[model samples]
Target: MSLENNKIFASVLTAGILLMASGFAAKSLYHPKDLEENAFKIEVSDSGVEVASAGAEEPSIEPISALLATADVAAGESGFKKCASCHTIESGGSNKVGPALWDIVGRGRAAVDGFSYSDALQGMSSEAWDYEALNEFLAKPKDYAPGTKMGFAGLKKVEDRANLIAYMRMQSDSPAALPQ
Candidate 1:
């Protein structure tokens, strides 16, 4: 109705258009591509379904036994920095948040003194801490021993697990031989 009113309307319309255009540009800039290309597939279905991507196969996990043959003990010791907060590796090392890991290789499960082990781990007392067992346990502690108190998410890399186990072997009075 008035020139001033027209100018105000135009300003508001321009601002709205600019804001909409910027939103569209941002959406185009940050839109995620198909996760299958990144080795991830989303599966949805009724009854809690799982779906496999059409194009990608899951990567095979190399057995820790194989990797231990060439595992770098030094690199493993370096990697142990991640575990230092929860464990002490020295001989007769008192239990920390978790049990002392000294001589852990080939040791019986839940055998450490004074440290209270979760029932999940204690259930594994029939087994020794062999290479295959260590690999599985270290790869995913929760998966390996459900209901256990170990809070780590586990190592995702085979090489890292192998190296870490190798380093742990060296901490023992009688280091276990690497798996063939």
Candidate 2:
């Protein structure tokens, strides 16, 4: 193998070993139930398959098998169903395997009250959830906030994202979304 490929392979192997040794479940570390908790966005295709997008545009997608409009609360709730595994929807509620969704709309990364956070997520500047920032994070969870403990690929339906954001907004006091 080329030197670069070897280096890449070595890096991946080391990471895998370290993560495995830490005793963190693969789903928690690498397949976070909710990338949305990390403040990401979503995209959609005509067939309703999730796709990633650059800007937070509501792409045309078929109705969710349970059809959701991604840019609003109702749809967000529908989209958030995917994230229920790691997070909670109640505001000011205790942290789950991840954190609570209450009031996270304008909250910053790793801003939850008592949950243990990865250094990478905490290293981020204190900010709140907003449109653009959420979009970037949702497009690529790990890319948006490097070292974030979340491990979901992200929502791929723009309408779903919008709907989800809307729902998240209702969970918090702030009407406008903030960015971290």
Candidate 3:
């Protein structure tokens, strides 16, 4: 019995040694070359935010004005489902996690009553939520207004943003005129 146990232990030790030797042999046979430049480079800011390298070209965003003309309000309404958790579109709807978005189009920034807006949005009080501004804001909330409390990452598709804006326009009693 002891002789049999000794044989099993010897076999296991030999297998482990072979496996380690094979790994070393495979690594020596396959030498990976270091990349001269990263395919995608990201930089970390002092605030620990990951920023795209300056050389990276951001995809050109089409103007919302052009898209809004033929934008599907129904589709936009569907998209608004994403915002429904935080906002209410119905007239006189009460504020939720986000302020009521009733007549948000063309409304002054931080205009909703009784909701606490972040200092970043409060600072933009002079600017109304125009289609273009909404376009940029919806593209990336953080990029549009750093330090904003809004946690939505934003819609990447310009068409989606246009549709949502169109739907928002309809929420008002008198929808704002579409841009020429």
Candidate 4:
């Protein structure tokens, strides 16, 4: 009985050794290289429909100008709820996780006092938070300012952005005129 157990252990050890050796041989025979870029790309819309291929040009974003004229401020107030966690919209509101957003429209980029902005935003100090800039930034924070610390994924719907901006416009002492 002891002899039979030894033979069984030896057979298992040999099998394991042969399997490892074959694995090493296979890996050495094939030198796999990572691709420089994705071989193919798939883009899906909000509705889950496949939208584009690898080579397709990015779909142009609809400008918010037309939508802002009649944007619902009430709806915008509701939308601002998403931003309230990080920002405060009232005048003289203290900064929270993000700087207070009172009168943010037309304010110079990275202009908030006492808040340390990322290098990416600081570098853009020359720019102001104009409607178009806000539109772009609010669409995709990372895309607009690559190294920004704002973790919000951004509002995808143009109407939602228009409403939010319109709401923000109302927060200022003198809201800038809507785009023509």
What global local distance difference test value does model 4 have? 0.92
Look at candidate 4 and give me any clashing residue pairs.
none
lDDT of every model, 2 decimals: 0.89, 0.68, 0.94, 0.92
TM-score of each: 0.67, 0.55, 0.70, 0.75
Clashing pairs in 3: none
> Which parts of model 2 have CA positions greater than 4 angstroms off?
1-70, 177-180
Candidate 3 lDDT over 1-180, as tens digits, reads 699999999999999999999999999999999999998877788989887777998776568898899999999999999999999999999999989999999999999999999999999999899999999999999988999999999999999999999999999999999999
Where in model 4 is the C-alpha error above 4 Å? 1-8, 20-55
Q: 3 or 4: which has the higher TM-score?
A: 4
Instruction: Report the number of the highest-lDDT candidate.
Output: 3
* Local error of candidate 1 at residue 106 (angstroms): 0.7
Candidate 3, residue 116: Cα displacement in angstroms equals 0.3
Worst 10 residues of 2 by lDDT: 61-70
lDDT of 1 at 171: 98
Error of 4 at 161 (Å): 0.6
